[model samples]
Target: MKKTLIAAFICSLSATPALAKTEIQFWHAMGGALGEKVEDVVAGFNASQNEYQVNASYRGNYNDTMTAAIAAFRSNQQPAIVQVYEVGTATMMAAEGAIYPTYQLMEEFSKGFDQSDYLSSVTGYYADQNGNMLSMPFNSSTPVLYYNKGAFAKAGLPDRGPATWAEMEEFGQKLLDAGYACGFTTAWQSWIHLENLSARHNVPFASKENGFGGTDAELQFNGPVQVAHIEKMGEWQKAGIFSYSGRTNEGSAKFYSEECGMYTESSAGYAGINANAQFEFGVSSLPYWDNAIETPQNTIIGGATLWTLRGHDDDAYRTVAAFYDYLSDPVVQADWHQFTGYLPITYSAIKLSEEQGFYEQNPGTDTSIKQMTSVEPTENSTGLRLGNFPQIRGIIDESLESVWNGTASAQEALDRAVSRGNEQLRRFERANR
Candidate 1:
């Protein structure tokens, strides 16, 4: 009887298993094809380790997801990680005691986290004045020009897109003469036409280091460079060379439909363009004003970063850090960049892609990289960090619409936008302070 009891106890002890991995919740706003890419990353991380499992929940668009996160945080149900758009940087930074700085989190949990591995242009946008990263740059992107090779051929223009604004206008005239309905169009009008325009020209878009310096930063986009560019775009509109197609990416439809010969949009527009456009297309550096400065400066980034939220236990935070380490892998970063058309966040990833000849096999894929990394980012070219940026973008959009509609001149519209946007900035400053 004693031997049988001992044998039963040994069998029960052998049947007992180890503790399950801690599951960490991650909330993001990626959807459609991009959402698929997010899932791919999560799957890779989950499979790479048995210590932690990351559960990604698709919240909605950037604004919607942010709202949900705020609500969740208020309710004490916040996830361990959340993806916030570039425009929301100020809001996240202002929410004291709400988020754990990713730099600190990594330091506590990941011995492998090295700031040097990250791309400077990417990290600059998400870093403090002292250059410490506040978040993990996941999907950084810059604007680029996309041209329809078929349309260019039909128009008897060079296969490559224009390098200067004058060349872009010339190509537009030829494209229009070739029976194309429009020569050029753009998505994210404010981002490409104004914010990035100022950066590329090494001009200030806002006071106080593009708003990173202090809450007192005010709009300065009403300057001569911005006015001249807007006026030129207006002239293009009057000549039927450029068409205003709504506020967002609605203009992209005009290009993919063959109505427009060229388009300026985010480098991340790759997947949609690849899947939707039937004609041959090529990507190139965004056109600059040849007379604006000697050469164009570095373009700023547009995309979201992963912020580690507070309220999570140490084990969960460690899991979040481990997941970030997995994400920082060169192979993983390269794959994400290739799949989504976003810039690789790490230098090692870019090098890995180059070694693999991904750029050679896929021409124009390196345009964003060259444009972003060719010049060391100056204070003016780093990025915008203004409060109420989404609202400010809306103000710029309305102002540009007035220009496109011929209701107001570029200078008049921009001056008005600056006036109105400054009011919002002051409001934000007061609230945050």
Candidate 2:
């Protein structure tokens, strides 16, 4: 009778099945080391829980990933979560019924979630009119001055980045005299040169407070401040003080190669710059036009945010909220911010980082943070909300390239870009309205 009972118990145990974990799909634009870090983050979350498994896919670069998500949404096969660049905020906001607002998702599913916990400068870019956050802030960055310390020493200049455009010019001349092939170059010419430049100078990039007011807003970046700045860059190009690397981050290579003595790029570029540069580098605040403003205002961000899409079931969304909650933990955020050189999104994360001595040990790592928080954001510095912004950026890129190549004057190029960009705004308004 004992043998019979043991056999029956074994058979019952063999008949039972293991529970399956719910699967969540995540699409992202991060590649290379950042991509590896994304995978590790997902693995950490998966290991921490048994109820849900997140499968993160590297779709491509920012534009490609966004395109893929839109295509997938149209096919009814979209991922549960997608990372969209900061510039895409307006387009995503205009996509009615496509997004599951982060505020609503967290309020409904996650406990102890406070929108106030996030940095207002970071969240304000992704928030609605009522100040409700639409997406989760991830990898936020602002442009800063990156200088080759070795070159600065060689040039007999001070061991610091230029505080104003005039100082930058003087530093550029000294760098050139020090035998650097290029004195300075910048990534994302439109973002760093015109957009943030205008904001720092308290000038409008477009009317309607840079389109935060409504879709009827028009381009106003061709103002005197913008035109004069571009004209100065054009002159620098002629003088070999400024090299036109490209419209995007191709300029980083110039800095990495030590061909350019100084670079104006995203703070997140620290990861690559630190990894590749054989010599030491120092970071500082983005240069401003002292003549335009008595003091520089806060610069805008340039990285991406994570947006939850519609069409996912409640269970999947619950898992997403859980994942987001995990991601928002001060420890987790501090780790990500330290590893990636992105901004710590929440005050707690910043405090945790400070307590960890990450900034003190890293030296210039806190420059971007200080540049962002040093001044309260003005209406011009709050953030841009232009529609079809990606396309508008392309227009501005072409126009700037024309100036760099000496084919058009600053006034002519900007006027043409403004005209062309306004057409895109009109088209975006018609489609979304």
Candidate 3:
């Protein structure tokens, strides 16, 4: 009955006749304010022209959302478009019968589709072996440093966040001396510290092409550098220079609310900071080790994309592709980037933004794009593609938690995590094979 009500509501909403608008179901995980942004974009598209009517429904977060879609697909009721995180690339690819390639969808439906317009590193992570994109990159963002200007003032340090990890430690110590509650706190521990941290340092997160080219790779987190960094962070925790707020983004609220001095969060945090921060603040690229003179090769993107699933009728699939094309239009993409902190996905949109003086007016908004697209990008920092990555992230989080709680040393934590995570790798490999 609920499904019937939803279908009837969509049909009634679709009755307007400026042009014959085909209804396409879009299932996504964005909710609350972010979900409203998703709805607003769809409504704008519906109002722009009548060729397509996209009925978007709210699914949950990445893991719950993907699970729901896969179940619905088995029941022959999946939405045409599903928002999936980058980590799920390999799992979706291995499901050979389940998805339609974004590359083909663009060619068949959109009048002109150019892959060259997208940042190579961004699309490459979500593409097939032949460089054909599998999903429309949406909300792509990289990690950045978020610090409280007031806290820095109190600590008698420069208002700007540190550029290197050693400097950050020195700054943290001063904040501690000033009796600050915690010098720094971070969100998404594994993502910011272990995965992207390794990439920025040009350290391997795993062998076997970071678990992309093949899945026979074993985990390799027992390196001295990783241990040393983790150990230092652990020691800082004891000295009240660091705090473990939570395993999730709840840590973001702490830093923004002035409960902590520094935070490492997504570049997309710009919108939240703009809305909520009462103290002076600044954004900086993730700090690197001093020896990594060429550190921060690149920060990997952390967001979901629109994935076209199979089993939808041909016209429905075409409609999905058409909607994606509309979203990618230079004007629409630019508008979305301006309103939200998400990086513009297409080169044309970036240029359009620059021409409009968007970045010139808003300082630090371009820091993420500049940091990510600065270099040609080495293999170490290009991106990662591991199957069952959600589970692997959980494993890493557990290990990091162990370090924070003093239940184990940093080296021991990583060794055990590698052992457990490699077991997961083996499972994914066998299942895919």
Candidate 4:
């Protein structure tokens, strides 16, 4: 009887299942110092509630993260949340039944829905025609002018940052004359040169809502303003006013080492920059074209948003929604903005920072936000919403590379880039429609 009772108890215990935590896996592109901030946000969310545990994973860069999510979704092993870059907006939207819209997710799963809390400019980009926001804008940023103070001093130029592209060109030439290897270099050349440059000069990169309204829109990057800027940059190149760093921001190493006078990169570059710079530096509004039609419209956001993936259980969705709420909390959001160079996606976070004198203490840190909000975002100023934008950007990269290397003239390259990019859009439009 004793052995029987003992055996029965052991069997009962063996048959019991382990208690499961409502697991929420978040796949993101943030790595290096950026990955650490992501983990910190996840940890904060996990600690805020025991009902849900958010597990953050770094999947690679933006493209890699999206590719992994698609594969995972196809295999029914997708995470509750996946962070995708701004370029992936249309692709994510086209992936029918794959993502749960953030506004809808907030209502279906959480009590923490506050659409009014988000910045109008940031959230408006990921929204639909009727102004319904889809993804939660998490790490929104714009390109800024990052100048090496040391380079300016060495060039005998005032330690002040240039306010216009013409001024920037002069400054760049001065640095080159002073024996600097490359006076300027940048990452995301298309983003800096074409998209942001277009908007900052109040020109359109495409028609039909910057490719948002319809996928059939063609790239108009060869317009007079764009062509002029490209040709000017090309002329500067031949004159040694600018230098090629590489295809991508990989050559951004020159800027980080204080070799370049000015570097145009995403504002999210702050963490790596703050850690690596051997000399003092500052940021300014991205230099604009002076005579180009009404300059300083608004810069488009870069970075990514937290896209909630489907095919997960209710428990998983609930956890993901709760994590989003946690990330959107005022204190949490404010800390994120200050800690990273990313813009606070919420209005309250900006107000809180102002109340706390965060911006007052840190001059130039708010330039991106100010530049974005300086004017009401018309259809043109809001942001780009292109299909296969990453691929199109690559075409631009090739065109620009040719111009820089003297293989193709600016107008010729841009015209060709537009033609090839429109073909890709035609493909996307056919499939989506």
> What digit string (tens of lDDT, one per residue) describes model 4 on residues 1-433?
9999999999878765344568778899988777898888888777776777888899988888899999999999898889999989988888768989988888999896888878888988898877778999999999988888887888899867888888988898899889887777787889888988887877788998787777778888899989898898898888767777776677568888767778888887776677888888888888888788554788888888989887878888888788888888889999999889899999888999999999888777898899888888877767788888889988999999999989998899999999999998998888888
lDDT for model 3, please.
0.84
Q: Report backbone clashes per prediction.
A: 0, 0, 0, 0
Tens digit of lDDT per residue, candidate 2, span 1-433? 9999999998778764355677889999999999999999999999998998899999999999999999999999999999999889999998869999999999999998998889888888888888899999988999999999999999999999999999999999999998988889999999999999988998999999889888999999999999999999999999889999888889988998999999999999999999999989999999988888998999999899999999989989989999999999999899999999999899999999999999889998999889888899887988999999999999999999999999999999999999999999999999999
Better of 1 and 3 by lDDT: 1
Q: Worst 10-residue stretch by lDDT in candidate 1?
A: 11-20
Please estimate how well model 4 matches the true structure, expressed as its whole-model Cα lDDT.
Answer: 0.85
**In candidate 1, how many clashes are counted?**
0
TM-score of 2: 0.95
Error of 3 at 426 (Å): 0.8
Write one digit per residue (lDDT tens) for candidate 1, span 214-313.
9899899999999999999999999989988988889889998999999999999988999999999999999999888888998999989999999989
Q: Which ten residues in a row have the lowest lDDT in candidate 2?
A: 12-21
Q: What is the C-alpha lDDT of each candidate?
A: 0.93, 0.93, 0.84, 0.85
**Candidate 4 clashes between residue pairs 3 or more apart in a chain or in different chains:** none
Clashes by residue pair, model 1: none
Candidate 4 Cα outliers beyond 4 Å, as residue runs: 1-19
What TM-score against the true fold does each predicted structure earn?
0.96, 0.95, 0.93, 0.94
